[model samples]
Target: MTTITHRLPQKRHLVTDLPGPRSAELTERRRSSVPTAVGSAAPVYAVDADGGIIVDVDGNSLIDLASGIAVTGVGASNPAVAEAVATQAHHFTHTCFMVSPYEGYVAVAEKLNEITPGDHDKRTALFNSGAEAVENAIKIARLATGRSAVVAFDHAYHGRTNLTMALTAKSIPYKHNFGPFAPEVYRMPMSYPFRDDTGVDGVAAAERAIGMIDKQITADSLAAVIVEPIQGEGGFIVPAPGFLPTLAAWCRENGVVFIADEVQSGFCRTGDWFACEHEGVIPDLITMAKGIAGGMPLSAVTGRTELMEAVHPGGLGGTYGGNPVACAAALAAIEQMSSLDLNARARQIGEIALAALSSAAESLADQGHGVIGEVRGRGAMVAVELVKPGTTEPDPELAKAAAAHAFSRGVVVLTCGTYGNILRLLPPLVIDDDLLREALDIVIEAQTPA
Candidate 1:
């Protein structure tokens, strides 16, 4: 793989305290301007970023482990993506594909069709966000199958949109009091090995979910079953082996559309182009975003040609879906992922991060600071779930404390999960080995009990 040289210094440097004077002023201003509901994990305001480092306004260089919630996998300021965006903007910004159309949008669709799982004839539709892609995927499935009910799994987080809010499981924050959500969405048990009280293996757990569908909402009423191969906001839970394959097979037998929500785990983030490839489970439809366009806002839903064609031409579209500049960025980002062999790079990162985190968890347990319930996740998208020392009870306070600790020490870490007890690490795929190890050391220190 070719080495990626970042413009900024790769190491973390604290020139001033986190949320320094400049950031504090911005925070004060933001409190009055922006709504309180839109929370920010890091208090510092970023001036620039590249590779695995984010430079704040106060001249603090912090290690970036969150990758802007799994976007920018190629890097925050990849030269190719930036150049493409600039070139596209120079030519023309938005002609609105629905109006005049352009080659960039077609090219992006072609690339998505080629890269997404399944060799079958496929079609692609671009959107502005992951939630939009998911919503459109569900719309296509319903129209194609002539069914109303859609099934989502436990601990799943689709998005914040009203329809997606109903699909999401957690009550607090994401779905709290935001009721009268779209109907016909059903929740089923997921194959979460760590939290499974039944102690069932992958196949049995899938059977349990299938049984629920059989009893409550039969297959005939179910239009599609959407799932994240690796649950993202839900603690980076990788379902036990055979779980995804069993569900996909069942969906096929029942004529229900199977949609893989790869919004968080797609684009070589999980040591594969998509996490479903890990299990060889090809979905009829797949939703992607996050890392698709470097840091540009772009999302897509790629699916079987027939299923996608079911929607009338005018039925699926938005004003800014597949904006020209974003498509250009996506094309360049995909090329970067291919030429740099980021899939292999992600595997290497996984090995390093998992080993370090696992060792830390063991050390903490031996020292009787056993808040880490489980260290899990694949590739660069890794996390450790925190729990009460002796029991499986969640310890969200510890997760928050650890994240705060990391931030204070010049590392940016993110916490997610229904209970907000999992510390997730999503470093850029191009992060240098030395820099990654240094960041991991700081993360280890932050996770340690004080």
Candidate 2:
């Protein structure tokens, strides 16, 4: 229960293979200066990481189960978030908290309004990513509920700008060809209990997603509903336990500003620092960003100090919004995730990754190698989902050949959903439970499907 030992070497070594030879010469100098629309699901080149490995540059150590996408939950080089981002980058690294102002951006907006999930009189702001804290939490819920239609669900993603890619619902590589996106933005239906076939519960999947948000928008023209209280990339989808307190009690009886989007399941990575606090469901605007700054480029929103003072003090900010060295690496990664409770180490890494991926999906459907249709998640945000054996369809090339054979046997694993077929995982709430059960036995021997 003390795990934070760093400086690499946790195990799983490998040596020279998966993009080896100095990461294939930096992936051929990152394919002549990056941008084949910037891919990289892992073709290895890291160089060095910590807690749960990641070395690379052909040296090869691997084993980090995708925490970078969940933003290094107090790991990748976290010596108290690299000495608070090297003492806030030797004094100053950007005076821009909307042009000169700091105290590490008001102590990271008083630590995201005293650690998120409602006490009531909350308020925050800070942003830089999670699509600028979800386009400023739909501009403070359409300027404190004057309303203008917003909703968003069905395999939702909610980021990649242009009003979070029109509140993302996936269109190959996050709304491909970007498109005529930012409009009124409506989409619903999501209580995905392993591909919902109508045996509904969770308040009948929140009354069939509030009957498609009251027949597609007009609970007085919405304003904000934006979810993801455990639906990252939509495959780690955990909806049905009274579907987010009956869609947050019908967005608090139609005033509509629910907005969770705890960007990749907020700090402590889902073992409840906020996955809408496992159904206590408070969100009246949350939208944080990948583990709030252990991997900088911070983001936030918080809310309900009358909907974050309903905009207009120079109508919300940005000029590197709140960058005093990413609010001193998010106040030293939220004081090393609340002095390393890391939300009970993300429910003990989600009860050992849901009992080792539910016993490797019941031993790969009793050796029929059924392509694991589900595994689900909670703390330490897990996933699995490949499908098509007895047919739940999706198998994204067997989840990209079981994450390229668990990154050629060293273990890195990431993949996601909206039919990319979800591998997920997101380790590092201070990893090392025997190197996370030997990287979940090399992701159940490289994603089963033989």
Using lDDT as the measure, the top candidate is 1
lDDT of each: 0.94, 0.84
Tens-place lDDT digits, model 1, residues 1-450: 588878988988998988899999999999999999999999999999999999999999999999999998999999999999999999999988899999999999999999999899999999999999999999999999999999999999999999898888888889888898999999999998988866698999999999999999999999999999999998899999999999999999999999999999999999999999998999999999999999999999999999999999799888899999999999999999999999999999999999998999899999998888999989989998999897799999989998999899999999999899999999999999888999889888987866
TM-score of each: 0.99, 0.39
- For candidate 2, the lDDT comes to 0.84
TM-score of 2: 0.39
lDDT of 2 at 82: 81
lDDT of 2 at 225: 85
Across residues 1-450, which tens digit of lDDT does each residue of candidate 2 receive? 565556767998886778787777888888899988888888887868987888877787888888888899888788877887888789878877776687878878887888888788887888788888898889889988888888888888888878888888888888888788888988878888887876786788778778877877769988888888888886888888888888888889988898888888888787767888876888888888878888888888888898888777989887887788878888888887888888888899899898989998988888887788889898888998988887789988878888888888888888888889889989888888998998888888887535
